[model samples]
Target chain A: MTETAVTRPTEIEWHGVSPKYIAVDLIGTAVSALIFTAAATVPYWLIQEPWALIPSAAVLLVHLVVLVLTPRRIRSIRYALRADDLLVRRGIMFTRLVAVPYGRMQLVDVNRGPIARAFGLSELKFVTAAASSNILLPGLPAEEADDLRDRLVALAESRRTGL
Target chain B: MTEPLPPRSDTQRPEEREGLGSPLTEGRGADLAGPLPAGNPRTEGAGFEAQQPQPLQSLATAPLTTSLADGEWHRLHPATPLLRGGIALIAIVGFLITNLRDRFIEGFLPMYRDEDYSGDPVEFLVGEGLLFWALLATLGVVLVVVFFFWLSWRFHTFRITAEIVEVRQGVLMRTNRRARLDRIQGVHIQRPFFARLFGAAKLEIEQAGDDANVQLSYLRGHEADALRRDVLALASGAQRAAAAAAPAAPNGVPGLVEARVQELLAPELDPAEAAAESVVRITPGRLIGSVLLSSGTLSVLAVLAGLGIVSLVTGEPIAVFGALPALLGLGTYLVNRITSGLRYSVAGTRDGLRVGYGLLSTTNDTLPPGRVHSVQLSQGLLWRPFGWWAIRVNRASRSSTNAQQQQTRSLVLPVGTLDDAVRVLELMLPGFDAATVQRAAAAKGGEPDDPFTNSPRRARVLRWFSRRRNGFALLPDVVALRRGWLWRELVLVPLPRVQSVAIRRGPLLRALRLAGVHVHTVAGPISSAIGALDDADAQRFFDEVATGAVRAAGNDSSHRWRSAEAAS
Candidate 1:
């Protein structure tokens, strides 16, 4: 017997994810770098004076480079539902093409942090049986996320029934 | 209902009549039998008639057999002893802590200085002061035990019903927990040295989805064994019943060996050709040489020697003597390796494949094809020249504990050609093609003609003090990628099993547009790294692996659940 493909919508419209996610991640990195810089000063205090700042400056430069590179490297992120699979494509320099089959879907959790709430965005996390199958889809409109979740759940249930 | 009276003369009541017939009337003269003379109306009465019919029918059928309607119910084994012992142990420790406060403080404090001792001499000199404090502490402990006894009686309750086992505890906060008979995974019985001496074993009931384990502390040896046997019997019986009802073969059944054996031994060398194949026997010299060449063991010996030398220079007597035993231990290891190498052998069997190796602790492991997760063949710089490769099989149950995990190494073969490796792989993983192995091997050394081969696009390749080549891809054509550092190699792990993938950019890498990728697998804490790559390439590989992982994981999850259901 030939297998029939289950069709689903190609594109889902979700609200734009909260800007706070990016801001928080960026700020956290910056804070950590600052702490590292402060810690590095101890050696300078002990022995080296002018050279300690050199190492600290190098660290700051590296941090700045990372900060500048990440956003540029993250290409247009989009998720689409095909007949049998959910596909997510992200990254610029190193493009990632991830496809999670509907039948394998276990649990879908939606969380909105304080920052996400401020920006009217939410995060969608999908967990499967294998530990590595966990995925975090950040920065989506709440309504769109809800719709996506419902559609995904329906698709998963249908597949489970061997539709 | 109404009470009925027997038909009798006015002189006698029903209670007074004992025998089948009235004693006063039976075989008597006219005077005694006068009351029984013609047409007694009492005998014809309805009450007398009803009683006579009922009693005669019941007696003729059978003696009236009546049993107690309110019989005793089955009571479960008590949890009292376990609770009492646990409470007693805790109480004793608490008592020691509280009552010995002064002595404990004195012992813990650094050697008391004369200048620090400022207390009155008279109080310190009087032993009565100490005695008074000890008595007061003893009274407090007694009160605590009394309270605990009351709590234990009130809170501790356990029951093993026909369907499940339950434990309800807590005096003030009452919590009740029950484990279904079906959900229990395994019963682990542990006996510590002291517990063994006291003839008690600790039982832990392991279940799925629960972080805390249900423990039955200090069960008598016989009782623990009996409980374990009952639980196992119940579990097995239920499984067998389910299997009988289901038409299909259960998943994860031990009998998969038949199919696996067929798959594993399908490729057979011609009898004559097999005999012609030369076996690499480990001679005494070779064994000793290999042991001496082992970098790990040699380094350990070197460290000890260095320590001995330092100690000798410092004129330490014990350190000088320690060197002799260390050398002797190293000698013993060498001999053991030699003996083990001599016995090492790998051969094919109709059932599966068996590899036997070891000297004192000889081990024989049979790898039926179905249990083999993955097969790997590798050649180090030295082995490459000799055209020899080591083969290893990844199995499931073999990964759980240390004994099996350690035995996994004994399954490895020292001398095997590429063809042999291909044959083994084909047997283990049915669909594996020889071309894939060739391509993978070619990709590792940066061969040009290999279509899947990728260059080591490193951000930095420093040949001087530090030689690090970072960005490299092996087996780029394969859907599930496996790569590792030069120092630590991981083989045949599917992408979906990777728990995390991290991409790190160092200062030099940032300048050179390069990064390092580390992939974490689920075996344990330690993760494998595929280091030193250009940033763009690393990110692309990361994304590809992640995508593949997601899909593979989805497939595995559904398959696993289906298999588990089938097993049940």
Candidate 2:
């Protein structure tokens, strides 16, 4: 039995990610991609056919596409914390968003790898009791990450304490 | 003239409480057996207020949390250690004795013919009284086990303090686990074959916090039952602590003291559960019929028939043998499903609901108020004719790997009629409106013209095979996703339990102008996929679900007792 018509939700103001994080991810991917481009030469060396260049060219083309698209992919990864839930949106094509409620958050952690440490950035992770609900917001400024983490911990504590 | 009860703890002698708490635990725990609805108090609230002390003042009841108080620490039955260690002891002793005979045959006897030897080692050992040494070693092994058993029995103790259920165990690394009484969700009493014979059982007191479940085992059957009631009574009494402040029943608070004494302290299982009407037991015919009617059963039969045909045509006859792996794989899955769902029964209890199932290994889990986070009612392809629905819920588990696997752990009713499914759904979700739920369950076709927004006919070409069944139904507390044509599945995620919501438009879907609202829950079989909704419908559903989840989560408070204390 339908009764009340609900109002539309306000537009989500997404916070863009730190660019240095993208540069670091690009360097690693580019390095591995270069190795693949180099490895593709093996078939050309052994087969000694002009057609083999087509295969080698394809690998280089894939690497080129990745080099071009990697930055855009990073730019697409955005997160926003609302009044009661944390919303993360990523992927340009598939476009996925997870709105994790503050009350449902069981654990929140900030992790920094060596590259992220050099870049002064870290990943903020929210762990909920649900198996599928774990959300990782990557490539955030270390300070921003820690601040968000503390706020998340505080909000989760307050909301959960309502029981 | 009468003073208001001082939360039960301030007035009663500790000795009297200890007497009422454990003595009735032996057998007839009928009084304390009713489930406590907590702050959602009705008749029992006043009764609980009178008999039990407030949870906060539980700290005032006991002065020390250090070394066990003389009477405070209750050891598991002395034979508990023996029960745990005896099997290992027997096996080790048996192995050593058997090893001696084997050694005599292989090492000693073979030495005469000489396979391999290092200067008659066996003969030298024999001369040094090998039999005596062997016997001594066996005795030493037995003695060590006996010593450890005694140490474990002596040190391990469980006690219900004013505010917490404390369990302390271990000889060297002593662990004191205290479960906050107010946070206690449920208690499970497991009676294993060996323990049941000795009239002993194990109590697992479930709390909301991780690894916070208090497990104490091998208690005399009666004592175990009483301790379970004791914990529940104190937990429920925590809510009524405020009611205890008033001289007479104040503002709709029921008889908490009388409820605690007569309903919780009296010895007997919950009377409500004992009545046959409260239970839905699976019959043998139903069990067999469900398995035979299952899609899995049909697929297996189809595969076998195909293999048989292939074997006949080819005449190699090895085709049947080649498909053994697939046959075995499906066999295990079929067996697992049947056994897991076999002999299942869901019963209503004072606290909430108790679900027991398993053909070979059974689990009797008690789910108290508000433990379930989400629920799903699904109809499989084959079971549609039978009007059977499988009701599964997402309850926070102890520890799990991922989401989908965890959903199966919270299975409330594996397979049941429409009525049984509704009854269980009501049990778990107290706030869910029954009328809406019934309407949703009875929904045959979720059409654009009907109640729900149907997928555009273009989706018919996209999902040409299973186009008819893909639709969604929105409720106040839950968002229902119905999918699949032959093996249909209905996934329901409570707004509050929604970890996140995703509006995904695949390249194909984007072209069709359809976006799916993918509601992610803890990994489980219940995947809420409200797919093929038009762009506007999808966007609206996503936004509304996101907001709904936020509102529901905000309304739920984890600590009601704390609020009650603040209010008072």
User: How many collisions between residues are there in candidate 2?
Assistant: 50
- DockQ of every candidate: 0.07, 0.25
- Please report the TM-score between candidate 1 and the true structure: 0.44
Pick out the ten consecutive residues of candidate 1 chain B with the lowest summed lDDT: B63-72
lDDT on C-alpha atoms for all candidate structures:
0.45, 0.61
> Residues B425-492, candidate 1, lDDT per residue (tens digit)?
54444444457565554244344544332324442263121122223343422232334323212244
Per-residue C-alpha lDDT of model 2 across residues A64-128, encoded as one tens digit per residue: 88778888889878887788777877776666667776766655667898777889999987666
Candidate 2 global TM-score: 0.72
Best by TM-score: 2
iRMSD in angstroms, per model: 34.3, 15.3
